[model samples]
Target: MAGTNLQTPILQVDHLSMKFGGLVAIGDLSFTAPRGEITALIGPNGAGKTTVFNCITGFYKPTEGMITMTRASGEKFLLERMPDFQITAKAKVARTFQNIRLFSGMTVLENLLVAQHNALMRASGFTVLGLLGLGGYKDASRASIEKAVYWLEKADLMDRADDPAGDLSYGAQRRLEIARAMCTGPELLCLDEPAAGLNPKESLALNELLLGIRRDSGTSILLIEHDMAVVMEISDHVVVLEYGRKISDGSPASVRSDPKVIAAYLGVDDEEVGDVLVEVGDTSVIEELDGVAPVAQGPAETSSMFEGPIADTVEEAGGETIVPASPAASKAAQVEAETAAKSPVEPKGPAQ
Candidate 1:
């Protein structure tokens, strides 16, 4: 908030599209992230969620549309036009992958120090004179070390500064990845599944670390996570994506209650109304939304939209098996799932 005026959004993604041969990874997606907030992008497997992140971070140039980031200093960057390094170097965007990519052979401190290599080189005057330690190279190097130590302290990795990165635990490795990104001094941090393989305790630690980053460092985070617990706990807002399109965007509470979201999860047609009523009970309100007529009938009157082939699909995928429903009930769930997938737009007010 200190750097951003209320007038412009921090990042604006407009009609973004991407393709992989015959597959459409992302389709005409658009959204905005404000100056200071943690936004979570969530979806089931193969949702094109990662593809969108890649496009924004310059890993994949979009087939169409624009990704614009307005910096705190009121500078505007067309992220799609820039190369990957420029996305980090000039646009001040940093990222972490789903898989932790650390310099396994390097010391923990050395890994972080490397993140600030460009800054330190500039400080040393980038010449043979500086390399010979004549133009404050020693002082600059010392300062770089101190900054790396500072981030390590922040990440609670100071104790392992002298250790090889490969020697740390899985959780520590994830934390170090984040610390390394912070070393670059980014304004926007894009994390891809930071909690993918962590145990319960490790996942909770990640939650705390992410919260700390937001509270103390003022860095806005855009994360793609499948861990619902992590998403529900820390995200200020949640966006849901399915296939290649955004379906829902709102607070956690609003998204959880959306009928479209339920249907998406269950993978059923909306016309199968009465099937869900038995599970959810008297879902007449939901039925009305899907334009289905209310049914007054016996138990066997329900249709089996979720039976047979549907059940087999769910079972094979190791997902929950939803009972069959009337046309209204099925529609409600689909509607809810889609609504739940929509990501929250930035609040049109001052940053907290």
Candidate 2:
């Protein structure tokens, strides 16, 4: 809810594409996460949301495009060129997985401490100084413990500090994972479905924790979440993906109201599309049914990313002047006839 610097982007993804063999997982997708803001990437399943995350976090090399991370000190790193480990270690980018990735055998406190391994290793001179308890190792060890304890309290896991991470409940494990990532002192935090299985209360707490991180530490966050409640509440910007392409990008309110987004998510049966367009305030589509060409409004006027009957509906409404299908029943009958012809041998009955 607080203001963030929209002009200064902490991460820039430009024309990014990823391919698995012949399958294009992400295609020419571009978006930005501004410094100290919560940006959410959301879509229906198989929309390539996770693929974009993988490319950003170095889990997958993009087939095309640039991934740039700019730190507060003005240091810039080309993330797509970095190894996964180096992305976290040198570039100060940290992420949590869709599945929990905690060290199950380790204590909750130890899990947090392990996230600080690079710093501790530097302080200990690898292991010799640490084993000898000499030089700055003692001070560094104390500092690591202090940091671990700090995050544990923030995550509300201090009561279970000595318990094995595996022993915590599902929600607790989720919080612990975030706490572990926070211990790494990340400049950019990428979270994959942090609220996937959380109850209402846990989800509320998670929202508070994320907001606190942004407010107190100014850490930039990019999250992939299906929980619209969380996304709508915390996100300053929202980018939508559908079938490996970005379909919408704007503030939560704007994206939520975009007719293209509505069609993509709810899906338009050809029979219902004319009404749906009108319902979403795209009344100009009805002009097509009345024989008047509607004036172009924007890029969405003649372009669409949907498939099947929905695609036909959007294109017809926006693209060309054609014979009027004025009555809803006439449009439905036309679609049913086309569908029947495509599959001739199917059992024919009243349509569901």
Candidate 3:
């Protein structure tokens, strides 16, 4: 296979739209994800972010628009015309879900082996040639095992390859699921909320694995993440979505400081100011990010943001809520989320 074009886009969504039962989920959204880079798609819960992913990945036919995907081999596939299976098999696009989608009962190695089902089936000639004593099937099976082992090593789960996927820690399971997807040999990998519900340490591990995928495997990645820390830390490009429309697209630093992005997050919870530190270009604004102002609609319920295990309490100083990332890191996380809602949309911008 030819190498990916770093300067050229691997995926392009042109004026894409999706509607269901008279309600528009996405509206004339257009964006290009460059090859061999991490691109993040971020938005509030109902901003129709996942709808855009669905349209691009062929889970939805799309109400209108084109999803053009250029492969490493320089073949262009119109994804909108393809089914989900064809998109995965032919276009070489693979995706992981917000929720880890693995067969919990299956061993870690089995999950990856399952990802190679198409390849193995082909190798077996649909079992017809295999029954007729095909010679290559043995080599093909061995190759599949080698591929599975390679990904297991990459994920650092080689020690648990024989263990049930469910037996691994939450973070390990996340890596295992990603390894299964990588085993499919995708040119473009789409990850949906890969950091959801993960601890800070687990999030760090996930970031490293994703970075390895981009740097070593040379697979372009598209991500939908609410975790600003993860998004900014690894993404080469950022695309912001609001109500299914592209709001901002730029380098991480540029998007992090855009007033539009700040306001978009503010719209999520006007009173909650925990993320204001990222809302502006200056770090001096950190003092202003305290306490949640009561909104008439109440706090908007959204996906996990500034969230993790609730192991501590939000402290109070002089009747004012103090958001802590203090010595008690656990309490600080809670305070951060208390001041911000579940889906606090702000970019940390690759900074600690």
Candidate 4:
């Protein structure tokens, strides 16, 4: 992966916080996504990751914190102070939702052309010049169509250009939404769960498409996703959040190895997970168990998010911690005990 100059981040969230009367969706979280990199924000359900996205995109005003965005040309703007339209127009940031928000009744080409509405409207003097086909509206219209066609080809949807967006396959719709966003010519693209319902083939295609966008267009991507495969495979940097706060931020490998992160995924407190030395054999010797040996977490390993297993509190016999005879039994007993201890876990509050 290519690296960017570290002097300034393309988007910087500083001590950001959000409150909805009494619920704190985000609490004093901060992270910097460098320009030209795919920075993935991931966490368990209800981690307030999307709330952070909303704050950055000007959908919600932060109770406290500063969002500083630096344009490609070196102009810096306080994003929190800007309106949503300014964030899109001046800041050059684009976003796609988890739910496909395409114009279902419109043709695929029309949906993308609509993304360029602002530029066309300007060229048309807000319809007066466009209706008369006067001024530069004709030229602008041509350029807009050209841009839409360009993105359609890139997304492999040119053949569907005249097709209604709602009639396309689910995966095609996902690609179309992304292509529609790209027509706006954004510097920073924020995607929320682009791979949500994609099949393996569709997910792979998305990976290639995003990589092409970064390599060819130099657009920075900040994404919120639960798909670990997508997050770990495509992101240049990964930020992990827990309970509305950042628990780890680094390269995928570094964050994966961090014991705190291991604990987070394993549903154990960092303090309870001891470093373990594993020796697998017919009579394997496992030491440093402490009845809470931390499992070495790999990229995107936890499917259950907030729920995971803990080791059984076995006796340390002859200076060697004993694991249960049957691995399955151990997991069953451990999970049951852990659930009993942490039962009635409070639901993570609603996202704003």
Go through the candidates in order and give the clash count of each: 38, 0, 2, 0
Worst lDDT run of 10 residues, candidate 3, spans: 302-311
Candidate 2 deviation (Cα RMSD):
10.7
lDDT (C-alpha) at residue 295 in model 1 = 28
- Ranked by TM-score, top first: 2, 4, 1, 3
TM-score of each: 0.75, 0.78, 0.75, 0.75
Report the Cα RMSD per candidate.
Answer: 13.3, 10.7, 12.5, 12.5
Provide the lDDT at 116 for model 2. Answer: 88
> Which candidate gets the maximum TM-score versus the true structure?
2
Candidate 4's residue-wise lDDT over 1-352, tens digit each?
3333556789999999886653456778899998899999988787788899999999999999999988877888899999999999899999998888989999999999899999899999999999999999999999999999888888889999999999998989999999988988988999999999999999998898899999999899999988878887999999988657787899988876765556545344433433221111211111111122223432121322121222235433354544343222223334334445445677898898
Candidate that beats the other on lDDT, 1 or 4, i.e. the better one: 4
User: Distance from true position, residue 322, model 3, in Å?
Assistant: 33
Q: Candidate 1 on 244-265: residue-level lDDT in tens?
A: 6777788877766665555554
Q: Per-residue lDDT for 1-352 in model 2, tens only?
A: 3433456799999999886653456777899888889999998887789999899889999999999998877778899999999998888899999999989999999999998888889889999999999889999999999999988888888999999999999999999999999999999999999999999999998998999889988899999999989999999999998657777899999988887666656356866764555455442332222222222321222222221112123123354633333222223333433444445495799978
Relative to the true structure, candidate 4 reaches a TM of: 0.75
Q: Mind sharing the TM-score for model 2?
A: 0.78
**Best model per lDDT:** 2
- The residue-level lDDT of candidate 3 at 90 comes to 95
